[model samples]
Structures are given as C-alpha cells and as structure tokens.
Target chain A: MKPIQVALIGLGTVGCGVYQTLHIHKQRLEIQLGAPVELTTVVIENPDKHMKIAEKTTISTDISDILYNPEIDVVFEAINGKEPAFTYLKQCIQAGKHVVTANKEMFAAHGRELKELAQKNEVQIGYDATTAGGIPIIQTISQLFRANQIQQVQAILNGTSNYILTQMRDHQLPFSTALKQAQKWGYAEADPTNDIEGYDAFYKLMILSDLIFDRQPDQKNIRHSGITGITDEAIEKAQQDGKRIKHIASIKYDETGNLTAEIEPIAVPKEHPLYAVEGVDNAIHLKADIVGDITLTGPGAGAFPTASAMVEDLCLILSKQSAPIPVS
Target chain B: MKPIQVALIGLGTVGCGVYQTLHIHKQRLEIQLGAPVELTTVVIENPDKHMKIAEKTTISTDISDILYNPEIDVVFEAINGKEPAFTYLKQCIQAGKHVVTANKEMFAAHGRELKELAQKNEVQIGYDATTAGGIPIIQTISQLFRANQIQQVQAILNGTSNYILTQMRDHQLPFSTALKQAQKWGYAEADPTNDIEGYDAFYKLMILSDLIFDRQPDQKNIRHSGITGITDEAIEKAQQDGKRIKHIASIKYDETGNLTAEIEPIAVPKEHPLYAVEGVDNAIHLKADIVGDITLTGPGAGAFPTASAMVEDLCLILSKQSAPIPVS
Candidate 1:
C-alpha cells in the first residue's frame, strides 16, 4: 500500500507532541492503517528552533510548502490563532489535503465554513483535538450517538481552569493561589484570561454545540462567566455542603427546542459525574433521548492526549472509517 | 440510493427494542446515511408471540429465511445462548451478510471464530451491544484507542449484578433479598445464577479482553467470584469505610505480556470512578500507555440502551463507516 504522506503546520507544544507521537507510534500506526503514515514535512515559523525535532523531515517556514504539495495527503494544523491558521487550513483543504487541527478558537468561530469547504472539495477535516482532549467526544457524538437526540451536555472542558479549581478545592487555597500553582505547573499560560475568564471553555463549548446541534448560538445571547469571581467563601460553602466547585460548560435544549448554553462555576454534588473529575482531567456528560445518560472522562489537555485525539482522527481518515460531518 | 435491507433474528426484549428504534428513527437514519435503512424481515422463534410488535415487517420462524435472502444486507442477531445463535450467524456471514450481535455469551466463546469468518467472507461484524450496553466501549477501544497499548481495564460490566449490589448496600439488605428485588424490577432474570455468579460479567470481560488484546485468556485460568458471598456485614463495613462494594471485572497485562483477569466483588473507595457508578449504570476505566486514564459511564442494560448500541452499529454499516475487526 502507498504510504500516507503527512505534514505538520506548527512546531509549538502540541505540534511537537504530534510529531513525537507519530514518530513513536509509526509502526503501530502502519499496522492499524494498513499503510505507513509518513511525516514527510514540517512547517515552522522559525526553522532554526525546530531543527532537532524536525529530524529527517523537510522543514520549511512557508505554509505554502505543504499547501501546494500534492504528495502531502494530510496536514495537521497545531497553530493556536484564527488569522493565518484558518487561511492556511482553507488553502490546504482546497488543495485536497485532509486536515486535522487542534486550533479550538479558530474552529469554534469558523468550523462551519471549513467543514463546508472540505465537503465541497471532497476532503475531510478533523477537529477532535479541538474539544475535550483524549475524550473522543466528537467521534462519539458524530458516530455512536448519531441516531439519538442529544438533549443536554454538561462538561468540565478547560484544563487550566479545572486544574485551578481543583487546587482551590483540594488545598482550601484562594483562587489567586490556585492560579499561580496552575501557572507553575504549566497548566496556565502567562495571560490566563482566556481560561480563567471562561472563554476557553466557551470556545470548546461552541465547537461541541456546533457538532451536536448543528448550529451555533448567537454570541450576545450566550451567557458565560469565569472562575475569577469564585470567592474563597463560596468554595468553603461548597465544601461544607459536601460539594466541589467546578467550572462547567453546559448546553441544553428546552421542550420547545430553545437552546440555553453557559459556562460558569457550579457547586457539583457528589452524585454528579463532573464532581469527581479532578485536577486537569476533562469530562463530558451527555443526555440523549435513546441512550439516556453517558459520561466520558479523560485528560482534557496536554500534548500526548491532544496528539492521541489527532492520531485517532488520522486512523479514521486512513481507514476510510471517518464519519461524515454531523450536519443534522 | 437503494435502501439497506436488514433482518433481525430474534423478537425478545432486545429484538423488540431494535425494531422500535429502527422504526422510530428510520427517517433520521435516512438523513444521516443518505439512504433509507429498511427492516425488511425478522426471524423469531415464536411468530405468534411477536405479530403485534413485528408490525409491517415479515416475520419467520426459520433462520434460513434471512440467510438465504440475498436482498438482506445486514443481520442483527439478538438471540441468547450459543447453539443456534452462533450457527445462524456463521451461515449469515457465509451468505455475505454483515452481522451485528448482542449475544455476549456466544461472543465470548466464539467471537474470534465469527470475526475470522466475517473477514474471510469480506463482510463486517458489529457486537457493540454484546458487552456494556450503550457505553460504546468496544468502538472506543477498537477505533479511538487502537494505537495506544491498553494496560488495564476495570469495569462494572453486569447491570443486574450491579443493581443487586447497589440495593444491598443502600437498603442494607442481604444478598438474597437484593437478588429478589433485582428480579422484581426486571434487572435480573428468574434464573439469576448467571448474573449473580459473575459469569455474565466474566463473559463481557472476556469480550473486551479479546477486542483490546486480540486474544482471550484460557478459560480454566480465569478467576471469577460472584456477589452471592457478600453479606450485610460486608456492606456495613464498606459503608463505614466510605466505600462501595462493586462487582468489578478487571483485566490487566504485565510488562512481560502476562495477562491477569478476574471478576469479583471489590470494595471501591470514593476516589475510584467505579465508586460513583450507581445502580444499573456501568462504567469502564481504561489505563492506556498514551492517553493515561479514561472512563466511560452509561446505562449498561435495558432495552433502549442495548438497542441504542445495535442501531449505532446499523448506522455504521449503512454509512460504510463501521470499523474493521481490530486484529492487532
């Protein structure tokens, strides 16, 4: 069988992680795909920084190097932002390359357009790593739960925020202390506003909402609040009530099909699945009409977990087992 | 597109559920598959008992009715036991019909033979409902976690056993009383020995073991114990220690590839995911080399949850997205 030529479009944390995962699991992937998955090229902003990591793969600073290459059957885009990543991915899709991405923010905003473009171009786009990392929630929702009407989703999606909240609850620390601890542990970025302000979870929530409901809510109508305002008193009160304060992202449809979505802190009782999802782990609890209730809990962030999700997508694409974009 | 002609080879609890699910979701399925999924025929042991439920579909007492019908593309086997279920499924696969089964007992004993037969005949076999109902564990392990080396799987596999244990702990009842309550609620069969003796969980565990490890352990080497030995004192002791007595089906591989599997009552602590899994809800916690720890929890039994899994298999087959038998 011909090898599946693959390219990497970034060399950041998740990008490097994907590179290492592909390298380590190359033979295993070959056996799974029944075709070798070769990482033929790597695109970095600065080729100088990724020399050792790039290894034998051709390194280029230009996205066009991969975008224009007919041999590159798949591109894994690990860039973080909207502007160039979106443009590069769009061009890659148009070039007939199947794309797998970890850009949650960009996907949340422009996933519909990208999916439509991919469909028109007769290529596949995978964003499993864009949501709850390693959870396989996207594939589960799209494939396994395709026939069921998913009525509600409650999740702890952002690892940084979840880690911070776990620290606060476990050690009885203040929010600032927990944030600092999370930062030191590499769970939080320098400017943690996106996570602490609930925007990170909100973006992921939007991605899931789009996949499950096939529509995004009006931005202004969606309610969201961060964990920045979760006071020490509130945490103490929750503890006293035998509950854990968690940053929960939730979406539910009413009896009349009206959608309500929000990202905020909730005092979760012990009976709830999300209450036990501690530390940096993520959990998604889905309530569907046929299947009743199902919950998936796993590592929500980090390099290997994200790479695991991306590789699973690659496997699906390679084996021609990937589900169509759940449009309904 | 021509409708995918399908057959159901049983009209028991699960068979009726599959019929109802396929009937109710026919249009939704058509929209998803881009083709109609028509239940053209059903083969039941007693047509007299199922005429009302059979509705518009053809019902037959003979298995050859479905096996010989070239128009039938997929066959869902919901029969219990090994004799006819295994023989009928073998002939169906020989007839070039894709087969999906909910028979854990038969699958545990002869799944490998059936999968090999399906592969040789160039057809697909889906057994998602053979194990945990509606949790999607089989698909998750086969597809998402294919690359990762699953080091261990700890699961609550039997709903009847779990339901009885929950009642015993919650109501402080003896094992026999709990067993009676489970039967009264239809969670356990009249001959509840299979469930209470851990054989049900053992069979399901073996199925998972085969899927994940590609080999089943020697039946004689397996260690299995029932929840029948649990006394009121044991439940009280567990409660005092802030633990729950859960029937855990566990399989693990050593570094040297030695496999150890067992089904027994375990005193699960508060931190364990299985501790939170209450009543008939089943949970599987997987430890893999790459993704670390992941847990899937959902309704493990009942008509809808079991049918939900079978229908998902149907959807996969209809869309040509069903995963190949994981043979690594």
Candidate 2:
C-alpha cells in the first residue's frame, strides 16, 4: 500500500521526463496504481549540471548507494548504455527488486536471460519503452497476441530516420536538411548516427525478437542496411512511381519455423499499413494467424513517451502482473 | 494446475471460429500460456442442425446447462441478440464466472452493470473482440493510455463499411455493387443494415466509451451518419481535392471535459494516416499528449480476427495480469 520506493539509473532526457511526469501527475499516479511511485534516488555523472532541475530527487554518484537500500521496491534503468545497466538490472533481479527500463540496447542483448532471472526472482522486467515509446505494443503482444501464432513482425521502428525520409518525400527537402530540422525540433540527437544507420531500429528489433521469438536474434544472421545513402532523388523517384520509401525492419518466421530479419529501405505501396506512417513516428505491422494482422504506431522515442512506458511498467509491477510466458 | 474450464455460449460464425482456433492452436496456446487451455463445453441452440466441427467439446441446447455447471471457470459469450447472450452473460457473472465475450451489442447496451459486477466479483470481463477484432485497440486504451488522457479517437472500426466505401471509391462502382462485393468477400453480413446504417460502429463506440471514459456513451448524443450517403460523385470530388472519403467514427473529450462523438465520412488528406488504409482494412488513430499521436491498423472484423481477440483475453485471464485501468 505504501509508495514504490524507486531509484533512477540516469539523469538524462528520459530520466528528466520520468521525474517531471511523475511529479506533474503525482496525484493521478497514486489514484491509478493505488500507490505513489516515488523516485527516491537518481544516479548521475554530473550532479552539478542537472541539480537545478532535479533538486528534489536525491542525486547520487554511486550505484551502491541506492542498490543497497532495502526500501527501493523498483529501479528504472533510464541510462542509455550496456555494461552498467545490464549489471545493475542483474543485481536488482538478484535482490528481488522489480525493474522497469527504457534501455533497448541492454534488453536487446540480454532480455531472455533477464526475463528468466526475473522469473527466478519472482519479479518483473518490463521494457515497453524499448519498442514503441508509450504505444503499449509490448503489452498488446503479450496480452492480445497471446493466443495467436505471431508469424511476422514488420515495423518502421526508428523515428529519426523516418523524419528524414518523410521530409524528403513530402516537403521535397534533402536528407541532411531534414536531419538538421529534426535535431532542431528536438526529435533527433546531436549525433544522429545510430538512427540514420539503422542501429536504433536494430536494437528495437532485437528487443522484440526476445519478447516474441524467446531467444536473442543471431546478430550475424540479420541482414542490415541504413538510410544514410537514401538521397532526395531516390525519394522523388519513388514518389513519382507512387511509392513511399520507408525504413522497414521485419522479422519473419518461415514455414519451417526459422526466423529471419531484415532492416533496410524499401518502397512500400500506397495502401500498405506502413505507407501512411510518416514523419518522426514509429509503426509496427504484425501478421498473426488468429487476428489476421494488427499494426501499432506511435512515437518510438521521446522524453515523456519513453518515461510513460517506464511508469506503466511500475504500475504493472505493483499489480503483480507479468506477460503470459512466451511460447516459442 | 488444472486447465481453465470454458463454456462457449454461441456457435455461430465467431463461435465456430473460436472453437476451431482453440483446437488448431492448442499447442501454440499451451506453449504461449505455459500450459494448456481446454474447451470443456460449448453451448449450441440445436446440436442436430448446427454442424459438429469441434468433436471434443460438449454441445448444449439450453442456457441453464452452462449456468448451472459451476465447474466452468469462464464463459465465452459469442451469441448476439438481446435475449440469450445478454441474459446468459448476466447470469454467468452473477454466478461468479469470468467472461470473455465477442458480443458488442450487449456491452454497448448493458456493460456498465456487467463491468461493475465483474469488479465486484474480483474477476475479469474482457471483450477485446468487440471493438477492433484482432487489432488490439481496446487493450491499448485500457492498458496503454491509462496514464494519459486521450484528446480524440478516430478510427475506421467497421470493415464492412470500409470495404464498401473502398470499393466504391477505388473501382468507381455503384453503392449496390460495392455492397454486393462486400458481401461476396465475407466482410458484410447477409443483412448489411448493421454495417451500412452505422449501428455496428455505434455499438463499438459505446464499448470504447466505457473502456476509455468509464461510462456508457449516449448514442442519442452522438451524431450518426453512415457510408450509405457517400456517393460516387462525392468520392470523385474528394479525389480531385487530393483527398479520399473515409468513414471515421470519432469521440473527442473537449477542453471543458465534455465527451462528444460522431460517425460520418471525412475527406482525409493523402498525407493522413487513415488515407492509405483501404479495402477491408481498419485503423484507429489516437491523439494524446505523451505519445503525440499513435495509430493501429488491421482487420476490424472477421471470424479469425475477432476469434484472435478472444484468445488474447483468454491469455490475460489465464496469466492473471491487468493494468492501466483507465478513465484517468
């Protein structure tokens, strides 16, 4: 009945959003979850720079400061890195603490092990923010697609690349200009290589693969390409041919039950579900046996949207709910 | 751990599909659910006249047969109409059995009492099939959008109407021909009044209203106009204006917090998410604060699609998980 004594692993954009949204919607959170989700501690490298905004939240330069605290019911891994997020999450699971994370990279590499560990500890590790930020696609897959054979998952899962390509096609702008515009609009990072080169989508694909396929996707087997070389001329030509150029990341299970994936630029017909999906938005279109096909689209990355997913996970943990264990 | 006992209340198109889908995907269901989900009894109006497809499931002629059997853990209410399906579900809930129904009409009319009754019994009553079939839009609202207030929900929720409108617009066919084509494609019922008149969508709106708004939306207050009035000339004019006619059902919560709903044709721009959504395809676009705006697309209605939603509910029940109890 008490508030979830929580620790945040970073003080970055999403961490700031998590802190801000939780503060802004404090009363609503208490009513919705039947408990207050308090961010008791935040681990940051530069406490001096972020202290003005995160004054109320207890800032720490040490991980052990929060990890050793018995009052922390959950830890949110908001930091965008691999080694420490993975290590901290493992420790949390071992300590029987529930975890809610926005770290797609960490989940992409080690989700199956993390899921198993969470089960062993009888806790939950929810990564809704990892796929489509705040879209609830994770819960949709776990809850709604539970009874169907999820044959294929295809998505435009990266927002930055999408913004570039959509602007090129719709506004007749070049990719570089679009990228700069996205950065100006706060949709792209200062160094947008991960998004432009399809690495962000690759990370998302790995996370979904873990949730759906129940195994880490073999990195060597996945066919990968980026939108770096996709030019304005190509976009114009595709548009002239009545086609839309989209960065599509798709994983398909063959009749033999073998999973194969591709992340590349493709010409989608005008009527495809992913065709209408434009701008800095993410869309996932799935083909399941029972449901025929369902597509979910939303902001794949943002401060509040990403934070919203983590907060949703905190609610799930308090509800003591876990996704239906994946079949295969 | 015994299997959850089930009593299917109807064996019509969706009922038959549910039974068949359960049997066909029994292994997948077991693997996904970490156990098997058995269909113990099926309620049929007439075993002699109705085909015997599900050989293992027991067929019943009377409603009391299932209602009296306390061993049934859940009741699948697939039968429509006000008399049997509605009455039977009320009795089942009164008897403390969990329910997963595909009957949208019952939910639209009498769901307020039923939802409260289920909560009183500390059980779940899921009707994911009632809204978007396999598209998983219902769960998205109840779970994903719980923390955020939705500004508007605009959707192509009815596949029959969408198919008719799409054929009329794309092929330049007359209304009668397009209607015939929809029937031929199994998108429309023999009596297409429910779809063409927009009553089916109206009922779905009521269900969504309850799930999102936590109150039964008054159909009297809603502005209703179906695809029947969308003429070929209108479609031509829309195309000339670089737009397409789409039957959009929308409910908007205003700045003052008043809820208003409408079902009518909209001339959606080509750049819009709903523009490329064609044929029997259906899409729901949600405008919200946190996630900016998100859209989900798929078959809004089908034996398989609706059956898949039922299966998803079964997983939710079997797995013991719930969250984002919306109306926030």
Candidate 3:
C-alpha cells in the first residue's frame, strides 16, 4: 500500500521531533503498520531554520504550500495558543484533512468548535498530547470511559510547574530559585506565564473536558488557580504534614448543572498517586461513575513526548475510526 | 444518529457492570456523546440468569443473537479463562463485528492472529480491559508513544496478588490469610493459577509487546515465576529495610530482540513508584525514548473498571483513529 502523506504546521520543538521520530523509526513503523506512513511536508516559520532531518522529508514555510496541495491527507498542528492555531486548524478540517495536535491552548479554548467542525467535515481531531504529552490520557478517558459517566478529572498537567515544585520540595529552595532551576533545565519558558500562572494546566483541563465530557467550562466559569502561590516554606510544611505539594487541575460535576473546577497547588499525601509522580511528569486521574478512578502518568512535555502524542493521533487518523456513539 | 448497538458475550461481573453502567449513565453518556450507545443484545449461558436489566436486553443463549446479526457493530467479551470465550471472539471478528475483550488468556495465546484477522476483516479488535482492567496500559503505550521507541514496559499487572502482598505489608498478616481475604473480596480466582502462577501478568506483557513493539514472545522463551515463592520472612525483611514485596512483569527489547522479559515477585524500595502502589490496584510503568517514564495506576478488577476499559475500546473503535505512523 502507498504511504499516507502528512503535512505538518510549525516546525518548532515538537514539529522537529515529529520529523526526526518519523525519520529515525521509518523502517520499523513501516514494518509494523504494513506500509510507510510518510511525512511529505513540514510547514515551518522558516524553511532554513535549524532542524535535524534527512533529505527525504520535503519542507515548506507556508500552510498554502501544503494545504492547497491535494496530496496531504493529514496535517499535524504543533503551533499553540490562540488565533491562527484555531483558524488554521479549522481550515484543515474544512479542507477534509484529519488533524492531530499537541496544542493545549488552542484545544482548551476552541475544542468544542473544533470537534463540531471535524464532525461536520467527517474528519477526526486529536488532542492526546494537549494534557499529558504522549501519556494517552485523552484517549484513555475518551475511549475507556465511553460507556460510563465521567464524574471528575484531576491531573498534574504542567511539567514546568511540577519540575519547579519538585526542586523546592527536594532542595528546600525558594520558589524563585526553583523556577530558575526549572528554566536552567529547559523545563520552563523564559516568560513562563502560561505555565506558572496555571493557564497551561487549565488549558489542558479544558481540552480534557471537551474530549471526555463532550462539554467544556464556560469561558469564565472555570475556577482556576496557579502554582505561583507555592513557596518553599509551603513545601516544607506539606512535608512536615506528611504531604507533597502538587499542582493539580481538576473538574467535577454533579447530577445538576453545577460544575466545580480549578487548577492549584494541593497538598497531597506521599502515598497519593500524584505525590509519587515527581519531576517534570504529568498525570491524569479520572473518577467515573462506572469505570471507577483511573490515573495515567508520564512526561507532560518536551519535543519527543509532545511530538510522539501527535504521532499517536496520526495513527488514529490513519485508522479513520469514527467518534464515540452518543449514549442516548 | 442512532446509538451504536452493543452485544455482551459474558454476563459475569463486568457484564453486570456494563449493564448498570449503561443504564445509570444513560443521561450523561447521551449528553456527552450526542447520541446513545445502547446494550441491545446480550449473549449468555442462560437467559434466565440473574443479571441487571436481564429482562430489558435481548438476552440470548447463542452467539447468533448478536454475532451473526448485521446491526451489532461491537461485541464486548467479558469472559475469563479460555475455551468458549476465544471461540466466541473469533466468530465475532470473522463476522465483521468490532471486538473488545477482557480475556487475557485468550489474548496472550491469540492476539497476533487476532490483529491480522481484524485487519483482514476491515474492523477493530481491542483488548484494553484484557490486561489491567481499567488502567488503560495498552492504549497508553500504543497511542501515546506513537512517535517514540518503547524502550521497556514494567507493570504490577495483577491486582489480586498486589492486594494480598499489600495486606501482608500493612497488617503483617500471613500470605495465606491475605490470600483468603482477597478471595473473599473476589479479587482472586478460585483456582488462582493464572495470577499466583504469573500467567496473567505474562499474558498482559504479551499484549503490551504487541502494542509497543509488535513482537510476540515464544511461550517457552518467556520467564515466568509467581508470587507464591515470596515468603512472609522475605516480606518482613523487606519492610525492615524500608522495602516492599511486589510482583512485576517486564519486557525490554534491543537490537538483537528482547533484551530481557520476565514476570516474578520482587523486593522494591519505598521510593520506587511501584512500592507506594497498594491494595486491589494495578500499575504499569512505561519507559520510552520520547515520553520518559510514566506510571499509571487504577483498580485492576471490578465490574466497573473493566467495563470502563471496554468502553474505552468502544470509544477508540468509534473514533476509528490509528497511529500516525504505526509503531505496533
């Protein structure tokens, strides 16, 4: 069989990994999948940007360069946050190209519309990497709980915040020092607003809500808080109290329409799943009415983890599986 | 759109939960999925058996009641052990019905042929519940690491054995007493050959091998040991050393092939991710080239968790998503 040609938007960290991953494991992936699933084009900010790649994967700088061409059946959007990510994604769906993204920001804000658009266009949109970067939290919740009532979802969704908190807990360093350490280790951003302010986790939670609950928080209703309030003293206090400070994002709903959701640093016992989860790791805990509680932990970010998530989505796109059957 | 029609092959614990789950979450599932996924056909040993909603569904004694019918798009097989369960699943796949099963024994023995058969039939065959009930380990590794190499898979896959060990650790009780208690709680089986003998965990490892590496082990090549060899003195010694006794299943591959693969009881330090996991819980720790180390935990068995896993497979089947470039 012929390979399924793919077009990627934005050759950033994750985009670069996608290219490298496909290139490195091309033969193995082909052997298992029964044929080659190729990356035909990579749409990046600049075609001459520093990237590790072989000569085979053709690169492009414009979305039109790939989108207008009829050869690309799927497009992976790694560009994140607001605007064009949403607009470009919609264009992909409208063009009947299956999409898989590691962009939590775009999905958290615009997932509902994207889902509707994909369904309308009979294409699939995947956000598995949006939360737990290659941990399959989205797939687990969406697939595993399809027959059950999802009551709650709680997660350690931000790797940068977790890395900082882990440093504070281990070294008894102040938040600023820990944050600096995280930056030094490349876990945090230079600006770090989205990650440190809990917006990153909130965005992850929002996308999870859309996928698992098929409903999302109202623009203003999500009760979000961040890890900025965490201090070295707090981490020490938590340890003294036999707990660990974990940045958790959670959403809960009852029989009524009342929804309570938040992303904040919570004091968890050492034995709690999230407490055992350390470093730049991510985890999702699902409390379903029927499925019970399920937790998934893994690398919440990085080039390989996030790009790997998109690749997983690519597999799903290849399968051409339909959406969940509505329980009516 | 009408709900996807479901047929249950076994009316045991999970079957009852699947029924109750579908019934209890009717409204929520409908709201989220935008359509109803219904349990229209149920295949069982006897229609007269006491089951939740036994009277409501089209409960029948033969597979023809669901498998031969064109309307039944999905078949959830919840039976354990071998024999009829394997044959029934084969019939379902051959008849072009998408299959979701929790029968680890059947899967361990037949997954390769089953995957090939499903593809030939142009359908899906998923066993998310087969290994860890609700932990979603298979899907976690299969879809999440779609872009990375699965360096290794380590799991405490059997909840029954874990519960027994945990009781011994916490209460300093004899293994026999803990085993009795676990049996009373229905965590372990009457024979206990599969779990105590490490067969269950071994089979689960096989499934993971299929998902992450697409490689199946020759039965003779798999090293299998059981929890039976773990003594009370060993447990006490480990606890004195701030360690714990845990059953582990592991598979690692290198350039030559499987570097190491085995299932056995082991001593784990208090700080290891597997150490803190206790009770009727299952945890799978994954080490991938991309995502790093991610550990997932949840109830290993129960009516709801397994059904939740099957439901997850249903969601995957519905979504019809495959890996971008298939790793397994």
Instruction: Output the number of the lDDT-best candidate.
Output: 1
Model 2's lDDT to the true fold? Answer: 0.81
Best by DockQ: 2
TM-score winner, 1 or 2: 1
DockQ of all candidate complexes = 0.47, 0.50, 0.41
lDDT of 3 by residue, B190-298 (tens): 8887888888888888888877777776666677898887778889999889888899998887578645688988898866878878888899887877567778888
| Candidate 2 chain B weakest ten by summed lDDT | B319-328
State the lDDT of candidate 1 residue by residue for B74-118, as single tens digits: 999998999799999999999988899999999999999999998
Worst 10 residues of 3 chain B by lDDT: B319-328
- Chain A TM-score of each candidate structure, as shown: 0.96, 0.94, 0.93
How high is the DockQ of candidate 1? 0.47
C-alpha lDDT (0 to 100) for residue B291 of candidate 2: 61
* TM values, all candidates: 0.96, 0.94, 0.86
* CA displacement after TM-score superposition, residue A70 of candidate 3 (Å): 3.1
Interface RMSD of 2: 7.4
